[model samples]
Structures are given as C-alpha cells and as structure tokens.
Target: MMTISSSTFLMAVVACLLSPAVQALGVLPHTATRTPSSSSSSLFMVGRASADADFAKAPLTQDDQAVDPNVYNVNDLELAAQLWQVSLSSKTNQPNRPANTPFLDTKPFLPKDPTTKYVVDNVVVQVSRTGGLGMQLWELAGGRDDGCGITLIEGVSGNAEAAGVLPGDSLARIQYTTSMQGTQSSTTATEMDVAQAITTLNCECRDFDATMEVLTSLPPPEVVDTLTLTLKRLRTWPQIDVVVE
Candidate 1:
C-alpha cells in the first residue's frame, strides 16, 4: 500500500460495507455516560476497549484505566470489529455533504475482493478550538475518479491519544453535538465524513484548486468540544466484513 503523510488534506470514504461475517456479528448498542471535558465547553462520553466491560467505559477525564485486553484470533477480530461501525447518515442540506448513495460511489475504493473486512473502532475525543487535533494524517488514494480517499492517523496527541487512537487507523466519521440557533437551542449531531468530504468536491474541475477546497471543507481543528470518531483498521481474515459508519 502507498501511504503519504500530510496534515494538508485529511479525508476518507464512507461506504455501506456489509458482508456475511459482518451481518452475523450484529450491533451491540453501547451506553455512554457524559462527563465534563477539559475545556468544559461541552460534556461527552469517552472510553477505551478492554476485556472488562466497565474498563471499556472509562471516561477521558481520567488519567488512565484498568487494562486487560482479550486475546483474539482473526475470526474474533471480525466479530468484535462490528463493535464500532454501525450505519450511515441520511440527513442532508449540510454544505457539500454527499448523498446517501455516495456510500455506493465509495465501493470501488475497497479491495477487489468482496470479502475483505476491517476492524472498526469507535473512539471519542475532544477537539480544541485553539490547540487543534495535534495529529498528522496520511492521505491515501484509491486511484478512482470518484474522489474517494482514506485518512490514516499518525503523530497522535491531545484527546485522540488519550482515547487510544493509534497510527494507521483509518478515520471514518466525526460526530459532535451542536446547538442550533432557531431550533430552540435543540441539539443535533453534526457529522463529518472523511471520505464523503473529498468525493463531494469532485465536480466539473478535479484540479488542484478543487482539491484544496476539499481540504478546507474538512472538520478543521478549530471545531471545539467532544467528538466521537469512527476508525477502521484493515483485517487479515478472508470472507469478513468491511465497516464504514
């Protein structure tokens, strides 16, 4: 695989990645408890995966947590990977947001084999309005005209590292709750799909300017408060599922 490191353009694809093993592994809804973040700008639920159920729910406000990871084979990875990836968003009207079918447009970006699976991990992190995400991203292209791409995290720090976000993990979705002005302060989740961000920018001109605009449209480091991230890592097992949430 060809991986290039850059903080320049960070984007990825969102796909309705489903397979047999993935279907069998069903979704286990996780209940998260919200706590005050470092900046106190907002409260969010943060945790890390461990053998113990309680340990997996430790808040990021804490320095650390008990660790006893469960050993797993390739098949087991296929099973637990469903722990993160869930579904796609159908809401629209967000500027430059792709349609629900963009999930299909991203299919070519996957491996030629239909059965390849990935380990999808849901990690919650806090984004500072000033300090930024404090991480470097590796932009990966799938050699498609659809503008579909991938983002791999590196140089981790800030809440990302605290949440156990590892390098080489593919970023899928960034979800944050924000209050709307006219909506009576009603809160709604604002999500940024790394994959769809780049794809939506592909129109008449696929030139450098359009590419830079894609970068600009991304969820900048200035986005504050707590964010839940959907991350994907390649799995070695065959006949498994590929998840993108």
Candidate 2:
C-alpha cells in the first residue's frame, strides 16, 4: 500500500506493453516485436525477391512480343519491297535482287572456276565498235587452264567488244546467223566470195586449232555486216547486302 519506487514502476510498465494482451490491443506498433534494423532488412529482402520473380517472367509480357526475332523470308512480298543481297562468291550468293534488275529466267550463274564458266546468258546486250578491235588473243592449251579456249587480254567496250564481248572472257561459241540486218545463211564461201557469205559461215571455235584458224581467217570488223560473240565472262563482283525494313 506504500508508494512504489521509480525503477519498479518503470519495469511494470515495460512488462505490460510487451504482454500478449497489450500487443493484441494495439498499444505498440506491430513492428515493435523485432529490432528496427532487422525489420527494415527483412522488408528490403522481400521487395528484392518480388522484383527478381517479376524480372524472370518479363519475357512473356505483351510489349516484348511485338517485335519479331527471326529472319524474313526471301519471297515475303507483303513484309517489304524487293531487297537484294549481292555476294561475290556463289557460296554466299542469293538469287533475290531489286526490282530494277531485269528478271532472269535462270538463277545467277556465278563463275567460281573454269568448270562453272559457261552457262546461260547472264546479261543480254549487243555492243558495236567501228575501228581497232582493241584486243589481244592468246592460245590456251588444254593442259594449261583445265581446258582450252580463246581469251581476250586487254580491251574495252568501244573496240573489240562487238556482241557483248569483255576483257578476261573466254570465247565459248560464236553466233554466225544474226547480223545487223537479220538472220542470214551461207551456201559456200571463200576469201573471194561475197562478204555476206563469209560472215554467215559457221564459227570455227571448236578446238584450239580450229579457233586459231578462225582467228587467223578473220576479215576486218569493218568488212563484216554483223558479228556476235559468245564468251564466258570471269570477273569479280563486290559483296553488298541490302535489307529494307
């Protein structure tokens, strides 16, 4: 019944606040059970775990699915206009090209070596020159470069380029039918015969000997009415790839 000491009174107050009944009554804050530093650390850990879970599942979200991560099909016209992927070597070449390029019946015939030199006509065009055929010819033996053919060394479009001829081209077959006028034929021919007959004669590019004969027998380009050369072109093309989105 006497007055209590200040220390004893303080102990009683602390015990009451920690009691289950007082805690349930909401006398103290709910976090009061743990130390301040421990409670703050535990909340931070829970927030980090939630963030990690959300990050792990982020790929399945809606906005991330809008863009495609695969290659476009070459024939997919709807996705974009004609795009070209030019390549130097056939190993990396693709048949697709821009619309401006003429539509070819056959795929591009890229010459990787002598065996692949001859094929379909890639670019069909006629070239004409007046004087000085502007070319040098060398006889290649069969054992020299896999086989034999007449190849031009130095020339340009203005001179020896009649019938789409170009430098570094090996003569394949000659067209003796077409001329500046039209289709023409030969019955019999000699050096004294008409120039038309001489031009219409069959080409002699069959073998090295025959090719040499034809080369030696050629009248001047100014004398012939028409000339068409079939050559296997070997040149290097630059590597360029274009993509239109």
Candidate 3:
C-alpha cells in the first residue's frame, strides 16, 4: 500500500466510498455471487405469454361482438310504436285503400259462377193446420190473368224451412187425401191448381198431425184429412243448392 501508483490509489478510494453507499441503500454489490431462480424467470415469461394470448382472442370486427338484447332503452321502443301508428294513420286517411288493407275482404263471399246448375230432388214436406208451414206464398204475375205459380217469400222460417225451401221457389206438385162421411178421396195438384190447393189446406187440412194417414177417417166436419207438398227450384241466378237437412 505504501508503493501504490496515483491511478491505483484513486480507484481504491472510490471503491471504499461506493461500498458503504451500496450498504446504506440495501443494494447487492456487483461482487456478490447471486442468480435469479428458474421459477421466478418462468413466472415472468408466463405473464407476458398470457397477455399476448388475450389480445389475440379479441373480436376483430364490430359485427363479431356479442350484443345484449336488453341494451335497448325505453326511448327506442317508443319511437318504434310511434312509427307504426303513423303508418296506420296514413292508410286510414287515404281515399283509395291499398290492396294489402284488411277491410276489403269483409264483403259477402259468393261463388265465381253465379249461374251454376243445382237440383233438389224428392223433397216431401208434411203440412198441418196448427203448425202452419212457416212460409208466406206469393203468386207470380207476368203477362197472364191467372197466376203462373206460387213462389215462396224469402226469409220465412217454418217446417218448410227445414226442408231447404227458399224464397222464390215454385211449387211444382202436391198430393193429399180428404175423408168426410165414411168417404176418402185422393187428389194431386200442380202449379195451375195452387190456389185451390191453398184453399183446401187452410179450410179442410187445418191442424192435423204430420204422421196421420190421408185416407184415414177423421171426426165429423173435417174435409181434408192429410197433406204433403213437393217443391222445385230451377237453377238460374243466385246459384246455390237447396239442401234438405
């Protein structure tokens, strides 16, 4: 130490001063033989790797992000309702409605062919006096003094109604019998005889049971015993099948 050079003496003095300063700061000296553990180095590497993985897994586009349905506010729903009401008001105010409007379909539906043919066959209806056949008869008039035939007034409901008789039906034929004073007689009537047939029905055939035999003897003073009618509907305008139920 007595023979040290100037440069060497200065270096030793600096090292002595830095050693106490390092001890005061609690810092490890450079001459200490310490190495970081493998576990600590691996933990630091794993943290960096996890951060990179999370960034890679993020959605690339706005469309790819998941949207929550409940995120819409009340204001958004009110706007939608207002827009619908405006559309409905516009449709209502228009003079000519759009084809898509629902009101046009409410009209009565009729078949495409109005003049289709239909036949009602062998409709036998029993007539009694008490339960008068629920119908109003109108004598058809055109170009002739005597009535052409009797037509049914539409919308009358009765026993004939159940037999599918409609308004404007022509009475074609009728057959009945009358019993008076131990005598029985049968008579068939056509359109020409409708007036006489009606007279007989009102006067002689009043209030008889539907199931009673025409030829059977009734109590005194009753002229006509029983009655049955045949109705016919020709296919023309207002095409519909007159069905008996």
Which candidate achieves the best lDDT against the true structure? Answer: 1
lDDT of each: 0.34, 0.28, 0.28
Instruction: Write model 2 residue lDDT over 1-245, tens digit each, in one string.
Output: 23221111000000001011211211111121211000000011112234558656333223332322111111121111111111233342345433333221212333343222111222222323233343434332223332332322223333333333333333443333322433344653432332334242232123344444454454444444334544433222222245555
Which scores greater on lDDT, model 1 or model 3? 1
The top-ranked prediction according to TM-score is 1
Whichever of 1 and 2 has more lDDT, that candidate is 1
Regions of candidate 1 where Cα sits further than 4 Å from its true position: 1-130, 182-215, 218-224, 234-245
Clashes of 3: 2
Candidate 3: residue 1 Cα off by (Å): 99
Better of 1 and 2 by TM-score: 1
Whole-model lDDT for model 1 versus the true structure? 0.34
**Model 1: per-residue Cα lDDT over 105-172, one tens digit each:** 12211345544433332333433333334344443333356545443443344544444444544454
Instruction: Output the better candidate (2/3) by lDDT.
Output: 2
- Over 154-221, each residue of candidate 3 has an lDDT whose tens digit, in order, gives 33344444444444333444455642232233453321222233422211111112111211222222
Q: Where in model 3 is the C-alpha error above 4 Å? A: 1-115, 119-122, 162-164, 180-221, 234-245
Compute the lDDT for candidate 3. Answer: 0.28
TM-score of 3: 0.29
Window of ten residues with lowest summed lDDT in model 2: 9-18
Scored against the true structure, residue 93 in model 2 reaches a CA lDDT of 38
